[model samples]
Target: MNLRRLKYFVKIVDIGSLTQAAEVLHIAQPALSQQVATLEGELDQQLLIRTKRGVTPTEAGKILYAHARAILRQCEQAQLAVVNAGQALNGQVSIGLAPGTAASSLTMPLLQTVREQLPEVLVYLHENSGSSLNDKVMHGQLDMAVLYDRAPTAGITSTMLLKEELYLIGAGDSPGHNVDLADVAQMNLFLPRDYSAVRKRVDEAFSLRRLSARIIGEIESISTLTAAVASGMGVTVLPESAARVLVSSTNAWMSRITSPTLNLPLSLNVSSRLPLSPSAQAVKNILLSLLSKPTIEDRELMLVG
Candidate 1:
């Protein structure tokens, strides 16, 4: 029941040898063995099976190891929270984001707000696909992330920030301002790889229409896709938020897909089981507020409509 003994047992299992664990812990091998023995005596079970090569956990040991890992992680998180309390909002927060979608849409605004509100907090951003981001967040590697609603982990809670309308962006007037699936089927299109949520929706839309799109190129980044569309390479279906900045900068037109407007809801996901620090909570509040605010264009479109 001693936390220190449990720590020693974890180290032993991790290194697979008492000698290695002792060296890492900077203790004598005999002392490490005594600690493991004491733990085994307290638990009234053999935690490890020794072989010539190394030690392996028994069935009970595996269960104990699983619980012990969670305990140790919680303890470390507690220590970090205590240490961070004395300092000003000064701690490292690692955030994961979906590439090309969440980064341009919400990440920049959140970063700016975090910088202004919590100057002492260091923000580390990682960009990956939605599936990778979901995995990282569930495993506690990332504090939070903005991802599509398709992949939601069990322990994570999500709030729908906005539903972005997907637009068919093409060169030279967008082929009559509002094109149908029949119109898009005739033209060559550029799309992202299969892993993208947007691509999946595009495929579904095309399938529903009983049509096939002529895919000329597959690019990953929004910048590249915009450049391709601007240069008359091909047309693509992209979220309005993701394509808004690019279209504005390049003077390209974006019209909502008519046959079926593709709408992807962006969600802010955070681990409900983990305790959020005050600084992290503050940043989360700001982000939630930002999501509530309507963009100028959104207000204008509402008035016009």
Candidate 2:
């Protein structure tokens, strides 16, 4: 099967218009049409049916489309792997990260390392909640992601990077010290929006305690929520990594949440089925090494010390 023709066919079906696909592919519409036609001829079946509305894939077309997409993805991966093998630590790496996980202590150091060691590698960072990042990584949209260690998925591999403690953070003068879950429930809380692993855990803890916490705000960005907590708007529960950054910069104080010490397990998730590119593997190795570094834990301990 002609890979080019297969790709053209997939593009046409995706755009649902030969003209649109041609515009995207930067080829003449007639030429694009010919490619698709040739592919159908080679397959000995009608792959697409053109209607006044647009092009629609035939039943055979759908089957071919599925296989074609996978084949193209595999081919692209193969090319990336080959290029990466020849050029170690030189390539583009797209990493997805959960909201609070991208704070200074975690992602910044890794990015700095990439900048220094793999200067030729272009790094793209996408910030989302842990579940969203996990889905993106699983779908191959992300090379890897730092995510909360929830349950594992079938086609994704997760390696525990660290076990972090969650802290109750509030303004320095807020009427809180050695707070309990009940006291936390009484105060208005600022929290990350739903779908965040932190929010899910907080909700679960609240449910287990049969406590009704008043959530005053649901901010999507951890920075925004931290700012709110700093301003004495409300208290929030955050990973020690995030809380330490806030307390160090602003007049905020954080105490480890107890009654049940919230231990959030962080993980590095990568595609299990796809072989990682050498560059991606190199970045992953650096990240794993960083996670193993006693210095990281010592820094966290120093913050409390």
Candidate 3:
């Protein structure tokens, strides 16, 4: 296999434009495209789909890119192993954090930890919902993710970070008390959409026990959901930290559900398609070390450390 052609193909995929890739490679545009075509012909598979905007990897291409990235990374590491024997490591890592998990618990602390420890690594941080983050990981767009999904999507692997008790958040002015799941099922509630990750878990929990909640409204936005709860529009379920993000210092109160206690689990997920770069592995190590402390909502994280 020609390592040079593999590098060129990877570069084009990275930049998403043959023209841009040619410019970066300092080669003629036609020559760049031809080299890519030759690579495709040799492999006997269509790797990239060209569009008006740019090029995207096909499923086969995504798989090839994943393996190619790992191979190329191993090559660089092999070189670094000899050249920079005792030097500080340097590389780039792209990571995604699910929104609910990022609330004062993981995002900033994780960033600070990386900056303080692995100063040479360039970290690209992306914050989105679990569904989106999982999608990005599968497509080889993100190196790893810290998210809240007990059961991750296909082509991804995960380890548990923490198991948190789910709570019924309500206005502080209202009666603040521990409500059993039976009672919780009777309250006026504003829940996330039916397809929501949390909602799916919540529904499964309820279904397992053959219990149901009086869901009054379906809220898509956390801010709106918190506001409605604070206004006494309805109650919503969330982990303590996430509920606090919506109304930490405000009049909202957090109380755990009982009689079939509900729990929300957070996880660290990585794609099976790609190998972890050294930079990403370093970040993962740091996170595993740090999760033992009170970084989460004063809860004990089920960590490797």
- Best-fitting candidate, measured by TM-score? 2
Model 1, 1-305: lDDT tens digits are 87788788888887899888999999999988888888888889999998999899999887787567556656867887788777777677777777656345667788888999889888888888887777666545677788777655676888777777788887785566677777888888899888888889888888998998799999987678878989987788888777777678786887778877678888888776665666667777877888788877879999999
Q: How many steric overlaps are in each model, in order? A: 0, 0, 1
Which regions of candidate 1 are displaced past 4 Å? 1-73, 85-87, 302-305
lDDT of each: 0.79, 0.79, 0.77
lDDT of 2 by residue, 73-122 (tens): 67887877676675656767788877676233657788888888888888
Off by over 4 Å in 2: 5-20, 28-70, 80-89, 102-104, 172-177, 296-305
Angstrom error of the Cα, residue 114, model 2: value is 2.8
Clashing pairs in 2: none
**Predicted candidate 3 versus true structure: per-residue lDDT over 1-305, tens digit per residue:** 47788888899999999999999999999999898899889989999999999999999888788677666766765676677577786677888876566333656777888888889887788887788888777766788888778765778988888877777788745445677777777788888776666788778878887888789999877777867887887788887668767667467787777777877778888887566766678988877777766654344454634
Worst 10 residues of 2 by lDDT: 99-108
After superposition of all CA atoms, the RMSD between model 1 and the true structure is 5.4
